[model samples]
Every structure is written in C-alpha cells, then in structure tokens.
Target: MPDSDLLLIGLGNPGAKYDFNRHNVGFLIIDELARRWGFSLSAGKWQSQSCRERKWGSRVLMVKPQTFMNRSGQAVAEFAKFYKIPLQHIIVIHDDLDMHPGRLKLVQGGGAGGHNGIRSITQSLGGNDFFRLKIGIGRPGRGEVHPEIPVESYVLSNMGAEEQEILESRFDPIEEGLRTFIESGVAKAMSLINSIK
Candidate 1:
C-alpha cells in the first residue's frame, strides 16, 4: 500500500478550548471517524496527530493539523511530501460558512472561499486539486440569524446543543460517504455527500 495511499486532513486549531467550536467540526469528524474505524491516534510527523488504517487493500492516513488553522498548510505540505501523496488523493475536511448549517458538500479544485485554512493549504501545496469535504456551519448576522455575534466569534463559539446533535446525527452518512470515496472515487463520494439534505 506504499505506506499511505490516501491522505485525509482535518482542519482545526488544536487544544481543548476549540474542541466543540463550529470551526472545529473538521476535528470532531476526524475524531469520530477514527473512533469508528478503530484507528489509534499518535503524535505524528509535521505537527499533527494522526492514525493509519489498512482497509480494502489501501492504507488510509488521517491527520488533524496542530499548527493552528492559519498555518495548517505547513503541516499538510510537510506530511504530503513525506508520504509522497499525490494531490488528487488528498482530502481536506473543514467547516464552510456559505451553506446552511449541517449541510455537507464535497468538491475538488475550488477556490478557498475565504477560509484562511484553505488558503494556506492552497498556497503551500501550490495547487487547488485536492478534495474538500465541507461541513457547513453557516454565517451569522444574516437577517435575524444570530445577529448579535460576529462571524469570527460565531465560528469560534461552541455549537448549540441542537446544532451539535444535528452534526452528530450526520456522522453515519459521513462515514458511509468516506467509505464510498475510498472504494469508488470522487464522483461517487460527491453524489453521496452532496445529496445529504
């Protein structure tokens, strides 16, 4: 399996303080996936915590960058170079502010959409060909929606109980979608993940 045939990068700031924040949804998803797949975590190369599992005849490496959100690309680029992972085989899971909360969308080769983490990654990688699995946290102060909170504060805020429950509920489908991505390809993964309503 060449050590690691696929790389899954979850974008988030490290530390317990950011654990349940909306911006940390990527970390939450990665943690849940690691638990479900029985992948043990360890301090990994490139400023990240990671785990590797061999399944379906491939080595899947999952990482959560500990370099904080803005500098995530440094860790990602370093890891990818060390593993010799191709750009197309890398998947970055992160939160999105453009879509409604609880929505999931998978896309490849897109602009960062104002995400500093994504921007850093794109710059470090020197390309935008990697896959992105975006879990929507939505923007605040739109109409009557959370108007008191600023966008920065909103994302860093802990999710409301209802929001947390909603995201947890989608974990099953997210798992299935990731499995499909590994088994099939981006096309199938997109069909499965983007269709979630």
Candidate 2:
C-alpha cells in the first residue's frame, strides 16, 4: 500500500440522520473534496471511511471518522499510527461556533475551543499540535429566537436553507486553502485562508 503524505480527517457524527446537522460540516466538506477530486470514500478501516488520491504531487488520505464526534480521536490516531503521519501533517476539519456562518479559519496547534471532537483528538494525540480548518456555525445570541436552545441542541440541528447557501458559497475558498496546505505548508495556507472574509 502507498503511504499518504498528508492525512485529512473530517470530524462528524456518522449516520444518515445526522448527515445534514451543523456538526456535520466536516463530513460535508470532505464529501465535496472527494467529489471534486474524483475520489470515492468506499473503503472502511481504522474506524473511518477512507479514500486515497494523488493530488498536486502528494498522496493524500481522506477520512471520515465513524467513531462519532467525541471519540473521533480513536480513528484519527489509528490512521496516523498506521500511516506514520506526523502530527503536523494531520489536518482536521470541523464546525466552529466562534465565527458567523460562511466564515472559515485555518490554524495550527491550538486549543479545542470547547469542541468535543477536537478535545478527543487532542487527548488521543497527547497534544494539540495538528492543523484545524474551522468552519463557523454561529451561535444563537441573547434574546435571539433560539436563545433558549443549548449549544448541544443547536449544533445537532440541521442547518436552515439560507445557512446552507452561505456555506456553499465558501467552499471554493476552502478548497483552495486545503490545496495550498497540502502542497505548501500550514503557515502559507493560514495566511491565505485567514485573510478571507
């Protein structure tokens, strides 16, 4: 088997019922990348659905963890161990409540920001040195219509059509950022992606 130079892990819950939820943006981004790159995620291993593809002169492994959100690190750590991928080469994509919808930011070696999936990955890896592509899913503010909704309930809820539209509009920039990260390095990708509105 060919070794992957970079491992892209998308953190999300597995199951049809949770497919469209806000927390599943990671899965959605992976799906888009797979579709755009002509790779099919039909293989299952290491508690993840995975596919390999050579893009921009690098072998990339794309994985969607089946271990659900909180336990996602198990799958990620397993794949990283088997592939001998360093922490710096592992990139995780997940939803963020820090920014409004349609916004994204790329960072390396940061705290989990209260994201359970990220917390799990950080613990499993014994550190928080990997890269993360945070897709924002803005939280309900005080006195908002859903102000009473808890963060857990809000994240699991499906996105409204308008929110989905906004997200769809940001995919192009996200893809470019990913490509830059894979081909160059995280710093370069961060500079480009973080500058995006």
Candidate 3:
C-alpha cells in the first residue's frame, strides 16, 4: 500500500509450462528469496506477490509479476509509479543467452537483445534508466546444450538437469550480489560482483 525504497523485478513467463526454463531464472530467484526470507509473497495492490525485506534501512519491495514475461512492463510500470520508485531504484533480473552459464552482469540502459520482457519494460518506463542483473544462460550453439531457439521457444523450454545444477550452485552468489547492491550502491556492487570468476 505504501511506497517502497527499492523495487527489484525478476522477468519470467507465468504458468507451470515455463517454470524450469532458463529464461525463468528471474522468477526462480524471486521465489527462492521469498522462501529464504520467510516472506509470504502474498498478493498485493498491484496484483503481484510482493516480498518485503529491509536491508540497510531500505524497504525493498521485490515483485515477481504474475503476468507472462513480455507483459512485464505493465506490472512494473504501474507498481513503480504507485510506489514512486525511480528508475534508478528499479533492478531487473533476467537470463542472458550470450554469457556462460552462471555468469552475471550488471548493466544500465541498452538494447533488449530480443528479450521481450526487457523491451516491454523499456517501452513502458519511457526509457532504459533502470538497472539489470543479467544471469547468463550460455549460447545454445557451439557445443553448448541449448541452441538458438528463437526468443519465444528458447525462453519457454525447460532447463536441462545439468543447467539446473549450475543454477543451484550459483544461487547464493546471486543473492550475495543483491545484498551488496542493497547495502551499498550499484557501483560498489558492480565492483564486487563483476570480477566474480
């Protein structure tokens, strides 16, 4: 009901059909955080399950939109305006096929690279001033397990067991990066996270 000091979004398609896909890593992280923090993840004013957490005096409102991935902009834009969370205070976590598995990148304002969810957010927010915590899923071709399945098919397909293993291993590290981002600032977070090899 009240504005949040921070809003973190994890982009992913809705429905059990996409629950295990690489692209749904964002959703997975959101769910995992809810489980770890003992948050109810109950429905809120914006029709999103908002998990509340306070770190460094910041009331972080984490949302995993029930809307399918591409329509993410609608939920994010509306919720942000309601809470008055500035673009700078918004961070999106999504899977990136360009980077190796378990890799993460922090970027601000750029092309969507065919990610409809990001594209929708950019369009809805009127610009790309927000930050993105990109989790790399690795390119499909060139000896990788996944192939370029066009944006739609690729994001919907389930992750292989091996891929899931990799993701399971990186969960804590991702959470740590988020913790640093919340306790410190993005610059400091990046400095601490970018070099994680």
| Winning model by TM-score | 1
lDDT (Cα, tens digit) per residue for candidate 2, span 1-197: 13347889898999999999999999999999899999999758877899977987788889999988999999899988888888988889999987878678988888889999999999998888888989988887633426777888999999999889988888899889878887777778898888866
lDDT by residue for model 1 over 60-79, one digit each (tens)? 88999999999999989988
For residues 1-197, write the lDDT of model 3, one tens digit per residue: 12337788988877788889888999898888777767667776665667767755678888988778778898899988988889988989999877888777888889998788999999999999999988888776735644656645665788888888888877787778777887777887887667654
lDDT for each candidate structure: 0.88, 0.87, 0.81
- Which should have the higher lDDT, number 1 or number 3? 1
Ranking by lDDT: 1, 2, 3
Backbone clash pairs for candidate 1 read none
Return the clash pairs for model 3, or none.
140-146
The number of clashing residue pairs in each candidate reads: 0, 0, 1
Alpha-carbon deviation at 32 in model 1, angstroms: 0.3
What does candidate 1 score on TM? 0.95
Prediction 2 global C-alpha lDDT:
0.87
lDDT accuracy of residue 150 in candidate 3: 66
Q: TM per model?
A: 0.95, 0.93, 0.90
Instruction: Give residue 100's error in model 2 in angstroms.
Output: 1.1
Q: Residue 18 deviation, candidate 3, in Å?
A: 1.3
**Stronger candidate by lDDT (1 vs 2):** 1
